[model samples]
Target chain A: MAHIQLPEGLPGIRGAMAFRPATARPLNDLVEILLHAPNSLTPAERELIATYVSSENDCYYCQTIHGAVAAASLNGDEALVKQVKHDFHNAAISEKLKTLLVIAGKVQRGGKHVTTEDVTAALAQGATDIEIHDTVLIAAAFCMFNRYVDGLATIQPRDEAMYRERGKWIARDGYVNVSKEYLPAEVAR
Target chain B: MPHIKLPEGFAGISSGFVYRPETAKPMRELAHVLLHEPSTLTPAERELIATYVSTQNDCYFCQTSHASAAAAHLANDWGLVEQVKHNYERAPVSEKLKALLTIAGKVQQGGKHVTSEDVAKAREQGATDLEIHDTVLIAAAFCMFNRYVDGLATWQPEDPEMYAKMGQHLATEGYLAPSIKA
Candidate 1:
């Protein structure tokens, strides 16, 4: 049971966002622009950053749902998503992404954890300025998402199928409308 | 100096947001909604959450900038703001705000650190569901904001006046305005 009276079925951010649609509007907009907007970083790669940060924060719901999204987007490569979490250094992702992940991980631990050498290494790996910026933003954003969901004590369903389904939904349709569809009737207003 | 060649003279997130206005739009809007829009918690209280979380993260840019905003909103109560940041438990804020700050601190350490007992304690202090929700969100969001500013090694001016000016701008016009009012 959630600490608050969030809707029973909706999970993680969905329920928490539903709890306050005003905040949801901008949050979903930010997620949509950050993840789905056309950019050098593929949506799969971006979702992986979000997943990795959530995993570090130990927010089960965020990591699972985003892991599923990364998997669905990567031709259903759930194994690849797991690899990125376990040891992204060994994952099949490119050297550039590996470097980006290093930066993201540092940010996950603490902002000051990232150093000048990390940026130099990432630039050496061919990550553009915006790619590095977005990677940091993506990682930073998930810390908030992770904290918001768990801090609220929203119901975090462990059923694998549920996450897989939500993952496919977000990966396919994206976040803006998905937020609206999932909101409780009164809150949706 | 920012790791990226962001426009110079812009402070902290100002430089980064300019570097990527596409990302900045929603981020600024999110800030407005979370801290500016109508809520059970006062804007000062919300700004305090952001400032306190930044202090915990040791992000000098975020902590100072937001402390200014909190103080500006509270009749330039810089002393009050510092007291809350140093020791919120004994600070002059309402009991409800103290409880919410407890949850915010846990979120800063890491999200899972916040427990159900914390939530119950907050509710006992008369925090509404929305107040609890906003408190966590403010803390969580500041973590992101603090990291975004510091991750790239964005430049932060050392002068307190700069932060006071930025703080006054944010408190007066809110985050929906362009961060660089100068």
Candidate 2:
């Protein structure tokens, strides 16, 4: 039901990337750095940020997929994921995380919405510069991702099971395996 | 000098928020849900996503403040911040985060750029459904934030020292602090 003429059975951004691998590589590379590189923040936390932003934008594909990913990583705790989506502050998280989410919310609305005080709260709660930097990046990046997915009118699966299954695979293989270069052209189609 | 005016000595989003407290509240509430709420992912990681997206969108205020916040909580490594901003893949992070950033980048450009495989890749890297959802939300929100700030032409301080100092203050006080709230 996407606005464009993408191949049938195409789920999310992957199909679009397959259609244009050249553009996909750089995009993939960027994700590798921001989400998977190496530092203090865990993968689960990073993914949560994406889900939070997607939910705000009402991008069904992103919200469902990331929600599944978060659930899988949290030992299949879908309820916690749902709770966070409904309300982060009330969710059982650390003070530092609460503060960071505050800032993330600001970023989602507009960078200018964030304040020095917001940064101060995170730091007080033990957030580091790198963590802060990454948070902003994550929020900023998702803005683009949401638009990209929603903009193209990509096919968003209605099945929650599909997302859970895919989340398991992602938790195991990482993004490279799913790359168009690795998958057969027909599967990509 | 910002293209728009509110009050003197104001900087970044806080300043703008102060000018219009009522309108800013909803946005703040939305950000709170997107970021602070717990899930499989950590707050630090979530903040990093926000910073990355802001940087991609060229939102100076967001890039600086969130970067500072991330640094304060996670690593406190300004170098890493610069590295991610310049090139995230080369930056020091984990495999899973790298995958998430990939999706975030696409979000910055447009959501259509993301793929099912992208979600799969992120999931393969241990990204959960909430993680993926948060990633998209972060990207989408930043777009709105970037445009909001840029559209209004909010104040942006050129001094790095100023931001560093501001970062320290922000690290100490929450966004709801009297200084920040209008």
Candidate 3:
């Protein structure tokens, strides 16, 4: 049961979002900008960053949702997503992304945990300042998002198929479009 | 010297935003919406939520700045602000607010740490659904903001008065107004 009276059947953050649409608009807008917008980082890579942090935070809903989106963006490579989550250092990703993940990991633990050496390593590996900045923001934002979903104890689907289906929709339409379709009547107001 | 070379004189997160004005636009807009917009929760109460979370994160710049801002909103009652930061349970605030602070404190720690009982407690104390919702958002956003500032190791002022002064300006002018002009 959710901490509040969320609508039935919608999983995870979606339910909580429908319960209060007023706050949902900006939150969804931020996610759209961070994950779907045109940038140096590919949408897959950005979703991977969010997935990685969600994994570290042990947020099941976030990790699954973002992991599925990332996989969809990367040619339906769910195995790659799982591998990266299990251990990105050994995963078959570029030196640049791996180094960026290092910074993201440190941010997950605590912001102060990210060292000057970490930034230097990423820069040396061809990670631009903008990429680095986005990685930190993605990591930081997921921390908040994770807490929001789990804090409310919203219902979360465990079936992998649900994630894949949802991922396809989100990947096809992007966050804003899907969010608009799902906004509860009161929240739409 | 920050992780990135931020503009001089601007303290904490402000300096970091100046370093990358591009990201600052949406971030400032979010703060403006969350903190400055008219709402049932008084600006002071909202600032108190920000201050409490920052203190929990132990971000000196945020805790002090928002603490002063919160105090300014409450007629310069610095003592009251300090009390809320130190121990909201013992602080002289409404029973409803105290219950809400308990929820905010749990959010500062981690979201999953908050239980259904916590929500129930807040409801019992006369908090509306919207108040509870905003409190969670405030706490969650500050976690990101505090980490953003501390992650970069920005310059934080040690002077207590400086924070109080900034707080006064923010309280009087609101986050968007002063942030825009600054």
Candidate 4:
């Protein structure tokens, strides 16, 4: 049972977001810009950062959905997604992404846990100032997103196939389109 | 020194936001809507939620500033704000607020930590669905806001009086107006 009276059939943040479009629009807009907006960081890399942070937070729904999205963006490399979640340090990824993942992990632990050394290392590994900034923002945002989904006890689908299908749509269509398509009629209020 | 070369004389999240106004615009707008806009939950109660979460995160700047804002709204009851921070259960507040704070505290720890019993407790205390929802958002959002401030290692003011004065302005001016005023 959902803690709050959310609409039927909507799961995770989608349900909660539909319940309150007033707050949802801005929150969704933020995600759209963070993940889908043009930047030096590839969409795949950004999704990986989100996936890694969601995994660290132990948010089952977010981790699964975003993991699938990251995998789809990386040419259907679902194993890489699992590897990154289990242990990105040992995963087959670029050195730069590895360093960014380190920073993202620290942000998940606590803000103060992110030290000057982390930034220095990322810089040494060729991460731009903007990439570092975005990584922290992504991690920080997911903390909020993960908590929002789980804090409300939103329903989460358990099937891997479901996440993969959603991930494919999100990768091709982006968040704005997916949100509009999936949003229920009454909840749009 | 901020990690990003934020403009001098700006401290904490302010400097960081100013550094990247593009991201800051929507964020500040969201805070304005969430904290200042009229709702079932009064601005004071909402500020208390922000302060509570910031305290949990141990972000000195956020806790101090928001504590002052909450105090100013509560007719300068600084001690009450401090009590909430030290121990909300012992503090003199509504049963509903106590239950909500319990939920907020759980959110600060981790989302999974919140249980069905916690929600039932809040609802039993007469917390509406919107109130419970907002409480969770406030707690969750503060996690982001706190991390934004502390993650960048921004400078924080040391004087409690400074926070008190800012709180006064914020109480009267509201978040959107005060953010522009200060």
Candidate with top TM-score is: 1
| DockQ of every predicted complex | 0.79, 0.12, 0.61, 0.73
* Cα lDDT tens digits for candidate 3, A99-163: 98999898877788889999899989998877887788888888888888887778887899999
Q: Tell me the deviation in Å of residue B65 in model 3.
A: 1.8
Which of the CAPRI classes, incorrect, acceptable, medium or high, describes model 2? incorrect
Runs of candidate 3 with Cα error greater than 4 angstroms are A184-189, B159-162, B177-182
- The iRMS of the candidates, in order, is 1.1, 12.4, 1.6, 1.0
| TM-score winner between candidates 3 and 4 | 4
Every model: Cα RMSD to truth: 1.8, 16.9, 2.3, 2.1
Candidate 2, residues A79-162, lDDT tens digits: the string is: 878877789989976778778777777877765577778877888899886577667666755666678678556778799998
**Model 2 lDDT tens row, B1-182:** 44334566777677656665543554565555565545567666767888898887788888887778667666578887777777888887887888888888887776667777777788789886556766776676677667656534567777767666655554555344433321
* Ten-residue region with minimum lDDT total, candidate 2 chain A: A180-189
For model 2 chain B, give the 10-residue run with minimal summed lDDT: B173-182
For lDDT, the strongest prediction is 1
Number of clashing pairs, model 3?
0
Error of 1 at A178 (Å): 1.8
Residue A84 C-alpha lDDT in model 4: 92
* Pairs with steric clashes in candidate 4: none
In model 1, the Cα lDDT at residue B12 comes to: 90
Looking at model 3 chain A, which ten-residue stretch has the lowest summed lDDT?
Answer: A180-189
True contacts kept of each: 0.79, 0.27, 0.53, 0.60
Candidate 1 per-residue lDDT, tens place, A50-131, comes to 9898888888998999999999999899999999998999999999999999999999987778888998999999999889
Which candidate order results from sorting by DockQ in descending order? 1, 4, 3, 2
Model 1 pairs in collision: none
- Candidate 4 C-alpha lDDT tens digits along A58-166: 9999999999889989999999999999999999999999999998899898888888888888889899988888888889889899998889988997989989999
